[model samples]
Target: MLGLMQDWPLRLHRLIDHAARHHGARPIVSRSVEGPVHRTDYAAIHRRSLALAQRLAREGVKPGDRVATMAWNTWRHIEAWYGITGAGAIYHTLNPRLFPDQIAWILNHAESRLMFCDLSFLKLLEGLAPKLPHILRFIVLTGPETMPETSLPGAVDYESWLAEADGDFEWVAGEENAAAGLCYTSGTTGEPKGVLYSHRSNVIHALACNAPDMLGLSATDRVMPVVPMFHANGWCLPFIAPLSGASLVLPGPKLDGESLQSLMQAEGVTFTAAVPTVWLGLLQYLEASSAPLSTLKRVVIGGSACPRALTAAFERRGVHVVHAWGMTETSPIGTICGVKPEVAGRDAEGTLDLQETQGFPPFTVDMRIVGDDGAEKPWDGTTFGNLQVRGPTVTRGYFKAERDALTPDGWFETGDVATIDPAGYMHITDRTKDVIKSGGEWISSIELENLAMGHPDVAEAAVVAARHPKWDERPLLVVVPKAGREVSRDSLLAHLAPQVAKWWLPDDVVVVAEIPHTATGKILKTKLREQFAGYFGVP
Candidate 1:
């Protein structure tokens, strides 16, 4: 006999409706570009979203049509997101940090019909407007008082456009499998490929993320997602927070340590998520300032591994740091290194060590490590292999690209070399492309990078494989030293000597002013590879 559970169709609009009905008064706060904090509630957001939906429909946005948004994390951006999706249109978030050519290419590739952006990006939009053939209209997310007169005509103020719209509208109903949003991967190699998220996938991902074991979001929690809305929907916190009726604090265009710290204190934020660079700034700011994060309870660090020092600092301050691992393909949450019940009583050092791992898979995710011969490896934490995952949230295939990336059995190759312990904990050793092979032995650049970051003088580090005639390839360490701190190559190399295998140590160390990074805050090793391609051995 079938179970008596309700057969509910998961959809994005349903989540918004639930929040509006049950948690209408919950606050969704944002720090705007004008240096003022703007506060709204779920009811207002829902009403504005409906108005936005009506405006989008009037702008010729048909079902499944792509509506591109190039804006920061703000209440209006969130409204635009739900509004576009609620009207049966696809919401495509354009990363502003990408090159103009890449942005133009994505806009054309996605066939976006309507473009909504913040007033801050007027110059950027004007520069690339000539190349975006698919974008028929431009709507600035600002009032008429601040709308600038630019060479690119036909721009409409967001408030004025929505004023002519009506909020008394019904959400367009469609199949749960209908495409809801599209996000392009950071194109390190070829042109960026798109990951189309279905309404069902998004809703499920949001629900899974809200569970007590995962992010454990609630209406009582105040969240500040320092991760930009352009990056994997700020790791899906925007949707999950509103759905859970949590108070959201969005830092728009101002991610500096002072600004973020002030907002966190002012809003009494309990949870926040961002990449390592942003946290580094906050940690440094906290170290110098006497301000206490009185309400902060959890910090989610992803996009890169969190430094051990940073994790320890937060833990000492009574804030839990959950190191997460995922990509643009996995709805950006594969593993969250939360404290398991079994290890809850472990000593501070031991617990911190476990927290440093990539963590175990969440409820909806399944992970496995495959050897070169395609055989699954034992979970001993010593046998490193290529990581593969299959889940409800993982992308099945790239939009309009070859399906070869997906396995016959439906797993997506994560391209990360990792180890899974018997306890089901996964630790990423390195990316397949980033793994350095010397004399037929694999060297994990991630391990080296982590070790380098542990040095007090080193602020940032990236390890890239350099060509070597003797042993196929070798590693070159690029480091960004702490401000006003001096570090020599020998001293930094010595710091790692006792921490790693002898051969795994970097072959050469190069100090640089700064390490290049992708738009999503990941170190751009692809560019580093090109910069030092000719240096086969010690230069």
Candidate 2:
């Protein structure tokens, strides 16, 4: 016997409606791409989103149609999301950092009918316009004055476009599972594949991430999403913040240490989320300037492994660091490193160790590990295997792909090797292709990279396998030292020798002025492997 509940559908428009009614006056601040700040609230956003939705309908957007957005984490972009999705159209966000060829490929592949772009990216769009014939119109995310002259067809200013329509509009209703947004991977290995997000999936993901053990966000908190909207929907904070009625301070395109520091203090930001690299820069800046994290209370670190040293630095200053883990396929929020009640009796070190691992899976997600012979592995805390997951928010297949990328038993292979403790805490060891194999022993490059980062002189480190005559593959260390500081290979090796297993020691250490990174700030190990493929081969 099933109890009946409200037949109301879970959609994106309701989040803004609830926020506007309850938290109408809460501040939503943004440093506009035009070199000024813009401020609005839930009520204004709700009214403007309705106007924008009407405009979208007038522009011929229909249900299931794809409308792309190439803008930063600003007020306008946030409005576009609710407006586009509310009008029964999928909002496709394009990452301008990608190669022009890649941009054209995705635009054509998605068949985006209309694109909302920032003024900063007009030149890129102009150059890419001729190739993306699928895109019917381009709306620059600017006013008439700031709008640059372009050769594209039907180009118009954002303000003028929205002004053409009145704010009298209601959202178009549909099934809960209708596609509302489209995000693609960074295309590190091959052509980027799209992950289509649904209204139900995204709404459920936002609720799960808001649980006490997860983000723990409340209406009283102020959030700063340093992660770009192009990166997995800014880890879904754009949705989570509104649902929780939290004030937001978007940092526009300036994510440097100093710029972020100013926003954190000026806005009284209680919580923020960003990649490990961003926090590293902030910590370095704070150390150099001797400034305290005045108003910032907690930080959620993801995109890559959060190094121990980085967390340790923040812990010293009373700022809590939450190591988050997710992928584009998981609606970008799978696990958050929150301390469990079972860990209460453990010593401080024991608690810290558990907190360092990627925390337990949220209630909505399911996780398991499998071995090469197609068997589930034990959650013994030490047994590492291929990680697989399935949930309402996880993608079952890629967009437009001919086949599903899942195991026969219906689990999506995460391509990551990990271990889960008896208490259900998961720890990522390495990617399947990144784990170094030497003399029948498996070595985790991620572990070594973290260890190397502990060195005072080592600013960034990446561990890749190099061919060796004796051992089939040996670890090679690529180091990027802190600016103006000299790094010595021998000293770094000595520093790491006692920390890790002797066999895991790097074969050699070489310094590079800078390291290559993907658009999402992950170390591009693929490029590094190709560049250093013959380090051992060389005489």
Clashes of each: 0, 0
The candidate maximizing TM-score is: 2
Error of 1 at 242 (Å): 1.7
**lDDT per residue as tens, model 1, 409-428:** 77899999999888888999
lDDT minimum window of 10 residues, candidate 2: 343-352
RMSD of 1: 1.7
Residue-level lDDT of model 2, residues 1-539, one tens digit each, is 86698798999998999999999999999999998889999899999999999999998889999999999999999999999999999999888889889889988899999999998898888888889888888898889889878987799999999999998988999999999999989898889999999999999999999999999898999999999999997799999999999999999988889888877888899999999889889888887888657888889999888888888888778788898889999999888888877766767567567766898778789999899887999998999899999999999999999998889999999998999988788999899999898988999999889888888988999999887777888899999999878889899999999988889999899899988998889999998988887788842
Q: For each candidate, what TM-score against the reference?
A: 0.97, 0.98
Given candidate 1, what's the lDDT at residue 507? 80
Candidate 1 clashing pairs? none
Pairs in steric clash, model 2: none
